[model samples]
Target: ARLFRSWKPQLALHAETSGKNAIVVTAAADLDGAVRDIVKSAFGHAGQKCSAASLAIVEASVYDDERFLERLADAVRSVRVGDSTDLDTTMGPLIAPASGNLLRAFTTLDDGESWLVEPNQIGDCLWTPGVKLGVQPNSWFHFAECFGPVLGLMRADDLEQAITLQNATLFGLTAGLQSLDPVEIARWTDRVEAGNLYVNRPITGAIVRRQPFGGWKRSVMGPAAKAGGPNYVLTMGRWTDSFPNCATSSTSEVDENAQFKEYATAWAEHFAVEHDPSGLAAESNVFRYVPLYRPVIVLVGEGANRDDVERCRLAAKVAGVTMIVSRDDEADLLERLLTIRPSKVRVLGTTSDAIYARCDELGIPVDDTPVTSVGRLELLHWTREQAVSETRHRYGNVRVRR
Candidate 1:
């Protein structure tokens, strides 16, 4: 968590919490499968997986039954712990001895009355119930990921409270619910903050081909869609190809980087020849020289000034590109947007020398074409490459002189 805060990693895909996360089990829906899921997600691999269930928010109706709680605890105890090399070992040790010490600290951090569940004394963890709940939403342990064999349990009065408890955290990677009512399941699916949701199933152990996995909010910084499925491949790269026309237009004589003075001439004589006039410089004074789907464009370092920023915005709109302006160059703004499945990301303007070098080092294509008044030509040429259609006959293959 400290590393992420200090370094601000460009691409952070959170499948779990940095603080404690919650698992909501309604009174009407407890089953053997739910208990098994709680055991697997809460204690599997020593609760080291990001998808592990860190907290349990059971309904008051079921939690009031002391017998149920004891049974659940016994199930947790059934999990075996030993050297991972032994195939029979169901749990493993912490990455290091220090990790065990840190988890020990978490147990005492909260004052709330709780039950201790230790599958392995090597790194025994804590579990707290929300019944008669007192902890605030901002509790660091309540929202931070433990990354160990620790799970918290809370009791909710009803379905709504359970959902509220589940959604309180900053992370929204995966969530599991057990219910027989179709309407209740629908409500849970529609409202749960998680990107990956499971009904009547465990939150962990998602198969690649079967379940596309990813998350929302701080849980994932990139596209919120699943990574294991079809959408996953779209993030790899983007391509564009539009050849320039041999014949020149009126603007061909002007400086490629200079601002335009004769919009009427350019519109009537050149752009309007093949493109629709209405779409090309509508009443908004916004221009659309080329057609790009939904490309993400990052404006590097405010780009000279406010006018420069406005210019990039106009150009992106005309080209159908989404623009994000930021001075921080260390962050991979493109990858963050790519998680949402943008067509492609186009980087414009200047950034730090390190960032430029890093982009080159990582093979992330960078377009440093100057955003001068004549930048429209460059934008047009760039958009040509983003053609997604089979037929390239929409416009002439006219290239702008760089």
Candidate 2:
């Protein structure tokens, strides 16, 4: 309270989080009633905080609800405006005289609409009655976020449009919606991108202890705001480890019927020889590898040697490499190659011949180094080693290998 008092004439108190999250205040009720509650609660704090509702979107259905609007207007009018020290005072004076000027600016906007609550005076503080009524969507009053006792009301065409306008603001800290329809309410609660999605409640009533609070977009900065749940703590830790020779081994048996299976077996055999891991023996026909920081190499070729190509693809997959192939080179391998731009190309048999011819046509130098047919043991060691290295680097020393 002392800090708030010292900061005289506050224009806005925007909530910010250390993390990249947003706080959304949704009022699932009548718009006028919802705005009334927000004004009452916020002014209760002397309108010195960011959680206060500076602008409100009233649903079109209830825009003209006279009874509701009357009650809302009465609530704002009832605020006891006086000195901060007064026990009966529901709102205190502007921290300084200049704050009165800022509050007046918001209250005096000539957007072709009348003020529901005109600014008044209580001692040195500038007091403004709360507002609840019809306003334009693009009204300057609707967009301005006055920290004091001021609320702008605009009608949304539908619930969906209401949510969209609510989220449309760059300030995504808090929003409120009012509706009794459970399905409509649930849909808004889920689709609304605000950090907090409340149902049938006031936007200012967010519980700090039980509910983690923060804003998204410009409203928030870092990640330190505590979110509800214990799992949030794990988001702050880091780990690391190393694998010596996990890829050298031998190839396993082939299942002639499974296309991917043959590929998996061949790849396992290739990497196993480069890195020797006892685990390879059990899963020689499986393609297992984790992604690393390095760009992946995907191979796309004809199905002439589908079995051999599959094996190579499996090997690449296990090594954290990407591979792509066309149904056949005749369909346009150049286009596919242009799309992939692999760091290295592994061509075999007929596919190799087709690629070499294309490379000549495109004026790309083709390396004729004899294709080394690696045994399972050699391929295994290399695959495991690369996978382990990639895991270590990509995760910033977080040990992924068991």
Candidate 3:
């Protein structure tokens, strides 16, 4: 945050990884695609690349199946780590011995920490894949970004949990989700916090013009300038005669239809009492909540009672974000998740073991309290507050307002 605030170059771009990227494989995901993408993303380039998938979050459905884990391990082991010039070499060495040492230091877990793949050293620059299990949101395995062939593997109870774990990092460089189901793909795309998002393809190897890579949060700044894209030049400096005006215009043409215009006017008037000009858009801090931004929030669950669903809807209203998707029937949950392209999804109500197992993924901290007993609004507020407090504690005096 300090770097973001202090640095002001012609075009400022910052990329930092505490340790590694995380990958998620859903139960409905194609095993072939999962294996292929995981290997290519995790160990590709000797896992020394910035975009390497350092953590693999596999759904319990597959993780519980020892055979599948074995298959993944075998594929990882098959990767030949040696000299880049060697024809048989599948993985390459670190840039320097310091890099290897740094990788080892970042990956070395403390007592009681889960170790999915024991840290096995083959050479100073080359090492076997390191996998760590039971990674908490605050765990170094989940937060640190290591540059090496070492990868952490954790089993999530469901897809949502997997996604939650995947997104826990402050870094949002690249994230990959493997699932054959279209709904899962849509939901993952919407929820995962990464500048470069990959659905079946490998997370790394983004094409210059095609992918247009950039990061969010601590990962980057500016317009997420794509290296090979047409806008890549924009980062170099203004190509136009006048300094470019990049502010987004909220202005839109008023509707000409009489009925629509009248309806809009009436709607505005009906809620006039709730409107506040000095909250988000305005400068006064008198505590009026007229939110200028309304983010999309998705609610994924099954067996949600009427009250639980209503509470979630009410929370969305209070928060000024649209509740794009809500599911109580497990059968159609995935379909609903796919249809609604939500950016921030909240788990609401009591969901099936399988449903939670599949879609309740986020890398942020988890609140396992039942929705019926504890309202979704309460949970959301608590999580946000916790995050804010933690951020403030870590980087003192960082101003954050909701």
Best by lDDT: 3
Q: Can you write out model 1's per-residue Cα lDDT over 1-402, one digit (the tens) per residue?
A: 324423543433223233244666776674565677777777776776777777777778777777767777777676666776888777776665534434453444456644445323444332221121334345655676667766666767888988988888867776777664557766876577765566655667755544445554456433333555433454333322132222213543322133233322343454433221223221111112233344545545644444445555655654456666655546665355435444333445445555544443333334443443443243432342100001111134422211
lDDT of 1 at 366: 44
Error of 2 at 52 (Å): 1.3
> Candidates 1 and 2: which is better by lDDT?
1
Q: State the lDDT of candidate 3 residue by residue for 102-195, as single tens digits.
A: 5554456653456655656667766666655555566656676567766677778898888888778767777877776757865886577666
Model 3 lDDT-worst window of ten: 385-394
| Cα displacement (Å) at residue 241, model 2 | 6.0
TM-score of model 1 vs. true structure: 0.56
RMSD of candidates 1 onward, in order: 15.0, 18.7, 18.9
* Segments in model 1 whose C-alpha atoms lie over 4 Å from true places: 1-21, 98-102, 116-137, 239-402
The TM-score of predicted model 2 comes to 0.51
Off-target runs (Cα >4 Å) in candidate 3 are: 1-19, 98-107, 111-116, 238-402
Deviation of model 3 at 131, angstroms? 2.3
Q: What lDDT does the true structure give each of the candidates?
A: 0.51, 0.45, 0.53
